[model samples]
Target: MSIKQFLDKILKNWPVKVTCFVMAVLIYFFHQISTIDKKTFVVPLEVKSEGAMVLSGGYERHRNVKIIVRARAEQLASVSEKDLRAYVDLSSQSSAGQHNFPVLLDLEERILLMDPLEITASPDSVPLSIEERDVKFVGIRPSVSGIPSHGYTLSKITSDPATVRVEGPRSVVSKITYMPTEEVSVQNATSDVTKKVSVLNRNSLISVGTGTFSVNARIVPQGMVKTFSDIPVSFDNLRDDLAVSGEPVFVDVIVEGELLDIEKLSADSVRGSVDCSFILTPGHYEVPVSVTVPLGLTVNSKSRETLSLDVVLKPEETLPDSSAVNDGEEKDAENTQPQEEMEAVPEDVTDIPQSDAVPEPQIQGV
Candidate 1:
């Protein structure tokens, strides 16, 4: 066809052609809108603080944000909360005060491939309190609960890291004197108990360099002291013919042991003895008093460490038969004269002269 004829034919439907083109563009835009899908996610919000500054006070460190993301249906299916990040930078905040920063979002490489992507967060900005960062070293205190086993007691508590470094706002860091660990149970424990425990961060504004510590609790038997009075001392290894005289020696003993063992002890339970094996002859001697107690008991002291006593040799004697002795006494009584009759004769003899009384008959025995 000729140029003049083609121009005429194209100009003839120009208005109609323009109307059809606008309608087609509208249809395509609506089709694309229908294919795009919106997904909402709850993602953690992070705060960035450069230099010597940090978020402080009631500000939440891991704040959750509700975000709506728009992309193709296939692309949105692969999108997850992990693929999105929201944060607010506090590095520009030079002074210590409350400041508002706009929350910015970042998408991962996979999510970035989706063309015509749209993202919007409910809270576009957040208010935060910025403060100068401070660090301090504080001792660690272990917290314990429950009791040890019966007849046992808690002795000492220790931690592996005696001290830890704490970092946070100047106000919060300065107020902390010591860090306390989570409660370590020693219930029914007989020996030493060691456990790994986390340090309790009571204040949300502070951060600890060491989050966990090893805590050791020492358990030992309960100890008590008891005094036993008047414990008699016995002599040991004495000769058969030797004996102890002048009253048995008694001593008071002080003993230490477990509470249960000490409670069951008495004066009779303890024995004190003096060695007499070395003493050959009987005489006064100073000897040490040795005491013996139960296996778990320890002797603290004795009222008398050494006692003075007398040792003597046993006396020997022989007795006559009782029946023979009694018979002989009875015969002597029969042959004896009355005292009154003898006295009467004596009076008569007294009247005679001493020379005549002396001339009495003398009998000689065979």
Candidate 2:
């Protein structure tokens, strides 16, 4: 038949043409089904704190969910794990506590176009802890560990934002004095270092509003040793009855540090003092001289670390006697004389005669 005649023959019966058109559409869809493929993906799941309460630690699950999906072979090849995600909305919740919510998937236009089937997840629900959110500003401090290099020293450490805003549960917020960052190391470092670090979480109940901070530390090489003379020393806790005096009222302090630190060294910067709380005796003793300086500065005093000071009891004032003054030299001379005079006895002795009749012994024992 001619082309025009073939078309006319096929369209002559309207019911027959309609039936053939339906069969063609069914066969096309059936062929597409035969090429369908199934895939399983581990998609990250997230929870939304849509209500007045906040999620503690901003969702604490450490694992993702497993999802099984069916799509056309060609479309399945193009899909990836990143393309699938699941989340649960907690907008309907009004109270705070633990709750189990069903996981939900957000449908993308591309995903809908693939005509996905059997869209199911292994874990359809997850548990979360919610608490009343509280926010406040707290001071932030950077914590450092480990010592610097042998020849170097750490001069100063500071943070960009001294205070940060933190939001968390009431219990956690109440106990938080300050936010601290992760430990920074200065071991073997000889120069300045600045870095951005995250604030460490004290517990699982609170979150920091300003999550990161800039910390800077200054380190320098050991400088020349400088000695400061005429630094006055003071004593404390002296006994009330004791009077203490140091041999040298002024002391000399020696400090070794960075060049800049050594340049800044002065009599005022170096504090000299002695603690006299231990001095209970009244005598001459050596007391330790304590010298204080700024950070990164070392005081060098080993053998001559002490100062000699004399601690003695205060002398009592003597009052003159009026009666003794009145007595004068006359009373003094009279008192010098003895009450009665006595004759001196000789070394050698002779025996006396009885009743003047017997002769005295000539020799006597000496």
Candidate 3:
């Protein structure tokens, strides 16, 4: 049939032609609504900057900063939070000086204009330090085996710090001679423990990621730790009554839970402390301890441990009274007193160009 004939037949009834057009228009509208009923839009993510480029987002808000978006109920009911993802692209981050950036949404060609094209972030840019992390896993070789003095054995000598993380000028951490552990001079070490130990090689400028921040090695109790033969516990300050104690005194050390917990089987979770300045005192005392285990590591203490600290205390009765000293002797006493010194910071520091560069990943949140 010719085109004209077909048209004439279809349009023979003016009412029917008008009705058909109206029906087709209604179907189109219904189709649009149907899409709305099944699809959802992703909420846009805004990157806000403070004074610095909070590198890779931090804290709780920054970590999940990528917006949680979905289509209106029609399209989103079937989708899940797990199905959506907002990613910040670092490809354009050429040099990393605070720059407000957006994460692009790449849709599968079938979608249309139901979503907003872009959203802005706050603070805009953050102070960034683009530098390579001097990450090194230094092995802690405990020379003393962390065992106590005579007549005792370390049933188990695990370190609260199983691993030591060091970050500094790549060159520095790489050349490190050793990762040492502060002596835990216990007469007998049994069970597990959590102790806060300062990882030595102090360089305050160098930021330690707080993991195995200290070094510790388990002692098999092979033999007596020769290192303890002469570590005279200096009693610079002690009372007369508490002075004069025994050798290798077992110090009942109490520590917080969590530190001695290392769920990992076959590994010791022994913690340590560093204090050359811990003025040797008289009797056993429980002091606030600081532990530096691996960073981002949470502990579940299974066994509690104690510290057998053998110390030497000088009582007042054993020494001559100050009044008994002649003027000349007193002058000599003043000169004999040793002056105290200040502690320095850890030396190895990560070399990220601050202010002018993108921050090296804090990984604290990572």
Give all candidates' CA lDDT scores: 0.87, 0.78, 0.42
Pairs of residues clashing in candidate 2: 223-257
Once fitted onto the true fold, the runs of candidate 2 whose alpha carbons sit more than 4 angstroms away are 1-33, 57-62, 151-156, 188-196, 201-206, 210-212, 218-366
Please provide, for model 1 over 1-366, each residue's C-alpha lDDT reduced to its tens digit, 9 standing for 90 to 100.
Answer: 999999999888899988999999999999999999999999888877776888885466448788899999988998888888988888877889888788889889878778879999878888889899998899999999999998899999999888988988898888899999999999999999999998888887778875679999999999999988899889999898988888778899999999989988877889999998898989999999999999989999999988787889899878889999999999888767576466665434445566666566999999
Winner of 1 and 2 under TM-score: 1
Q: How many residue pairs clash in each candidate at the backbone level?
A: 0, 1, 52
Task: Give the least accurate 10-residue stretch of model 1, judged by summed lDDT.
Answer: 343-352
Q: Which residue pairs in candidate 1 collide? A: none
- Which residue runs of candidate 1 sit more than 4 Å off their true CA positions? 1-25, 226-255, 270-366
Q: Native-vs-model 1 lDDT?
A: 0.87
Using TM-score, rank the candidates from best to worst.
Answer: 1, 2, 3
What's the TM-score of every candidate structure? Answer: 0.66, 0.49, 0.28
Give the C-alpha lDDT of model 3: 0.42
